[model samples]
Target chain A: MERVPVLKIGDILLVSIQIDMEDQVALQLQEDLAERIVATGVHGVIIDISALDIVDSFVGRTLATIAAVSRVLDAETVVVGMRPAVAITLVELGLSLPGIRTALNVELGIALLGKRDVGDEPADDEDEDDPAAVTTS
Target chain B: MERVPVLKIGDILLVSIQIDMEDQVALQLQEDLAERIVATGVHGVIIDISALDIVDSFVGRTLATIAAVSRVLDAETVVVGMRPAVAITLVELGLSLPGIRTALNVELGIALLGKRDVGDEPADDEDEDDPAAVTTS
Candidate 1:
């Protein structure tokens, strides 16, 4: 399949990805996304990867790099739409995309964008009762 | 520090994170986010994690679960803002965050969401030139 296109949303730019992200492609996408984000002066970014099937170390590293550069651009980033099987595989393979923000879907991610704005506070749902959340590391 | 708050943009939501993301917390967050997405009907989501110390298998799985559930809710998901040191550490530690929608920062993650309405056309860049994109498997 072809690479995903870049689109603009109000003040935030969106980078939609729809293929197995490899090392080089991930790098190119990151560079291009960074440039576009800079051009638009968008502070928030959302990456849709609902179509990706496999992910490797190179792709993982590229993601980390993208986050790093986005910071330089004074923009925040989020990843959305990960597949369950892929998630399992990545975990089984012991692959990690460290320091990356993730959400269940784009909607929630966007809500998180302005979490403090108007949406309901991060309630202490039964799930939110994770010991880790309260523990100090 | 406390778990990052959920950000709310005009039509998007961004959630900043800075934790090692254990399975329990990850799963809880994903489900909660998914529910919120369905309720609010937001546009996109952004997960920012510029301060993660470690990642493990469960964490990856929880992220993947969130991605899949988000899609079912008809919303997109993206993961963003990963650090290089953490990326390498995950790999070395045999840890992975599962393959899902991903970005480097909140800027790009939001951008991905912005373009969803415009129809994210997969536009291959120079990176697609890599042999990896053309996987035999």
Candidate 2:
């Protein structure tokens, strides 16, 4: 019964699941995350699953539950570093995991949470799309 | 002064934007979406933006706002049919439109919303991942 370590980094909780999680372990991680979020008062949680080659329905549901819980606690959860195969398997499993945000990697996940903190809407607006489109088309 | 027509099919509100939307028109669509969400009590909203070749920051922000508003009224919103070029442009412009779910096309968008309606968590679970892993790895 290995406990998933939840590391706190600059207002974000990083959970890198390195173990092949059992059902009980997934539930334990869920409980651990809720407590960590409340204790640290972090604004974001990045779950790095790059090492994971498989994600069944139970784990997928746990991730979604974690996202929903983190949202309630005012913390954004981003699942990062998902392999293409895992993504395909999840879709094939019919588990899209709505209410969850994802990033290609940890760096992008941090950027996404940071951008979300700047404003309610997405940031960095140049308003040049129209002008650029005019010349291209 | 073109109006974005929101069609009601089954329990979903389909907003297919087939025009070169002005800023005012985008805002109008936002208001129209909110009204339609409350008026029809649809379970979902499918915003089709495949027709538009370009999307500025204003339009992106409007889409986010629409998602937020529709959520408040208890309807899920999914943006569909985004071209690859438009996606690249949106990322370059720095607007990811958080809180809005997206699918590749209208059929997939409808499937996403339909799947969401069946249950709070994703449906269709066959827990053979362990057995599948047994042979592969």
Candidate 3:
């Protein structure tokens, strides 16, 4: 039974799934992430799965479950860094992994979480000058 | 004050914002949409913004607000058919409109909303032989 480590950076929780993501491991990660979200009072959770060569239906469902649980706890979950083949596989498996947010990478995931917060800012609601800082190749 | 019409299609509410969104009009649409969601007991909302040439910060924020509000009311909001220029304007204005789901068109938006409900479905969690029905250009 391998345990996934949950890291806290600033106000967000970062979980990078580096292992093979067995059934038990996936369930464990889901439970651990929920508890971490509550204990740390973090508003954002980023699960980087770039290292995963394959995301089966179980792993895909686990990610979607973690996202739903995070939402219920008033926290947001972003599943970033999915490989193209894995994405195609998930689509083929009929697991769209709905209710899950994604980004091309961890940096974009963080920016997306922060971007939502900026939307609620009263002062910058009318600010027309954003640096257009997001540049992806 | 012109009102944005919210049409009920099956179990979803479709709001096509064809008019120029003045401040009052946007606010009214927000309030109207909330009421309609409650009245219709629908779980999905599709906002069509394809006709608008300009989607300023105010309109963008209003869209975000509608999304947040719909989520609170247990309804998912998907903004569809946004012109590329409007999207560029939103990014440049620093209003990422986070926490909102988007689709390229109304048909895709419906598919996205339907995709989430399939996630919670327990029976097909492991089904791998899907037809791969989703074909996007």
Instruction: Compute the lDDT of residue A91 as modeled in candidate 2.
Output: 94
The candidate scoring highest on lDDT is: 3
- The residue ranges of model 2 lying beyond 4 angstroms of the native Cα positions read A118-137, B1-137
Per-residue alpha-carbon lDDT of candidate 2 for residues B9-94, written as tens digits (9 for 90 to 100) = 55777666655567887888889888977887777998877656788897888888889888767788999978899999999998
Candidate 1 structure quality by residue, lDDT tens digits, B19-123: 446555566577668767877777567665544555555656665676677756656778776668867877787666554777876667877777776235433
Interface root mean square deviation of every model, in Å? 13.2, 22.1, 22.1
Question: What shift in Å separates residue A54 of candidate 3 from its native position after superposition?
Answer: 59
- Total backbone collisions, model 2: 0
Please report, as a residue range, the 10-residue window in candidate 2 chain A with the lowest summed lDDT: A119-128
Residue runs of model 1 more than 4 Å from their true location after superposition: A1-3, A116-137, B1-137
Q: Single out the weakest 10-residue window by summed lDDT for candidate 1 chain B.
A: B1-10
Query: Local distance difference test, per candidate?
Result: 0.63, 0.78, 0.78
Off by over 4 Å in 3: A1-137, B118-137
Q: What's the distance in Å from true for residue A67, model 3?
A: 48
lDDT of 3 by residue, A36-117 (tens): 8889788899888765778888788888889999977878899887879988988999988898999987677888888766
- Top-DockQ candidate index: 1
Tell me the TM-score of each prediction against the true structure. 0.43, 0.44, 0.44
